[model samples]
Target: MKIDARSVARILREPGALRVILLHGDDSGLIRERARLAATAIAPNLDDPFRVAVLDRDAADRLDEEIFALSLAGGRRVVWVRDGGDSLTAPLKASLARPSDTLVIVEAPGLASRARLRALAEAQADCAAIACYPEEGRALEASIRQMLAEEDIRIDPDALSWFAGLLGPNRAATRGEVEKLALYAGRGGQLSLDDVRMCIGDAAGVSLEDAAFAATAGDRAGADIAIERALAEGTSPIAVARSLLSHLHRLRRARIAMDGGQSRADAMRGLRPPVFFKRTDAFGQALSLWTAARLMEAAEQTQRLELECKQTGAPDLALCRRHIARLAATAMAGRRR
Candidate 1:
């Protein structure tokens, strides 16, 4: 079965008949977090060596034989496969032929639509495929509130709205910021906008987003500073590249909508997951700067650079830096005309 984002939390809590689930998407952080949550739901004592068995990507062959064996600890057992790749496909197919009561969580990066493992899980009645894309709009807001509520921390409405704009779409980073703010606020303290700015600052993915947008918006100096800050703070080059790709895709869609007779403002408003409230105006500005053709060119260039970064001998960080700089320079030079 395939489940929507809204159904994720509920399904994790009451997984009914789901015996195996494949959590895969571009958002690796969210995928891992959900895998952890699913593991908790299935085997609360994750620390127990026997109750939960983790099979890493390289050791995937073991799962082929491991799944048929009963757990020594018994009761409830969980078999987790992390960073699943093509290597595990045959093993998984064989194991799924006979459904075991044990819950199996397969964590993988975005799978193609015709991916064999993804298809297998989705087709099985006792399985589910959940995509863990970045949280946005209502889902992002709900996640903030839920995380805060757990810590008994209260945030002012405006503060929440401010955070809504700055929070990283990555679940792990977003949760970390929430936890940091919770501790900063102490118990039962109401968090204010200033409190958030002072506490979280550019650390919670603001620099990364700012760097991507500033580059596209033709602000080279700003993008340079933001990019530097983001890298210094440990954001990965691939993460920055992915963010740029996502923004470019959105720009292309907005441009397409405008060409089809919709006003730019209307097109922006129609965006699903909706642009962040704080980013609406800036995104509108991006639409003016990047035509659909230009955005497509940029997307292709970035995609190639991303591939280069992932290749064996490349200096990923340097290549990523060059890509962002070139794009920013290109955007700025075009705008001057």
Candidate 2:
């Protein structure tokens, strides 16, 4: 059956009697996270190699062998398939024809409506297909709260709102940032907006906002330092790329509004997250520098870099940082012109 996003959390909490769970989404991080949660629900000891068996689509044909095989850890086995698509349809169908103690999870990219693999999972009994897309607005806020709660950390509402704006389109990235905040705040600590900013500090221990601000404001040196520090601290390249894209998009929107005769103050005021008070003048300058066409070009570059980061066997992190730095340099040149 097809599982709704709202129902996924409850089901994950108690996935009882389900045999096959297929998670397909554009949010690769969320897909992997849900798969991991489902696997752990079934096979508690994930560290036990015997209890967890991760396979590629090429191993689909051996599903029966893997699932039915007795676990060396002597409990339920988790048969996980990463990057699944149409190639595994036949093998999956054959394996699901019968049942066993193992819980099978197939993590796939966004599937088309007519995709047979998605259809098979939805149509079959004892199987479920979940669609995960980018979470935003309230959903993003809720997820942030939940993750923080788990770490026994509390966040101020303003800080939560600010942090939420900085995350999503990637659940793993969102989770990672939250984890860092928790670590910085120490156990059982309350997180203020300043704390949130400091924990997300840059190359010289400045915040992510500082880097994003510098890059967009055409400060190449500051952007380079921030990007380098963020990457060195284990921030994913895709995360940084996404943020840059968001920043550019915001600038584009504001610039477009101004072109349509809206006043600068009015344009910035209409932004959803609302530009921080201190940055209003700088944001206005970005509006002047980044034309609509220039914004589109920036977005395209950021997206391409994100794709590289997600590609298999790619040194995505370094590539992402380098691309962002180049973008920073380009912005600096644009300002000079």
Best by TM-score: 2
Top candidate, metric lDDT:
1
Q: lDDT tens digits, residues 203-231, model 2?
A: 22234556677777777787777777766
Could you tell me which 10 consecutive residues in candidate 1 have the lowest summed lDDT?
A: 161-170
Pairs in steric clash, model 1:
none
Task: Report lDDT per candidate.
Answer: 0.80, 0.79
State in Å the error of residue 74, model 1: 3.0
**Model 2: worst 10 consecutive residues (lDDT sum):** 201-210
Query: Which residue pairs overlap in candidate 2's backbone?
Result: 201-206, 202-206
lDDT of model 2 at residue 20?
Answer: 86
Task: Tell me the TM-score of each prediction against the true structure.
Answer: 0.67, 0.68
1-337 per-residue lDDT for model 1 (tens digits):
8888679888877776677889988788889988988888878889876778898989887886666667787766788998987677788778878857777788988677788888888888788899888776667887898889887888877677657655555778888888889999998788977788678875826788788888888788888888888888877676677777877887889899999999988998786546666777768877778778989999999889778876877898888788888878878777876
TM-score of model 1 vs. true structure: 0.67
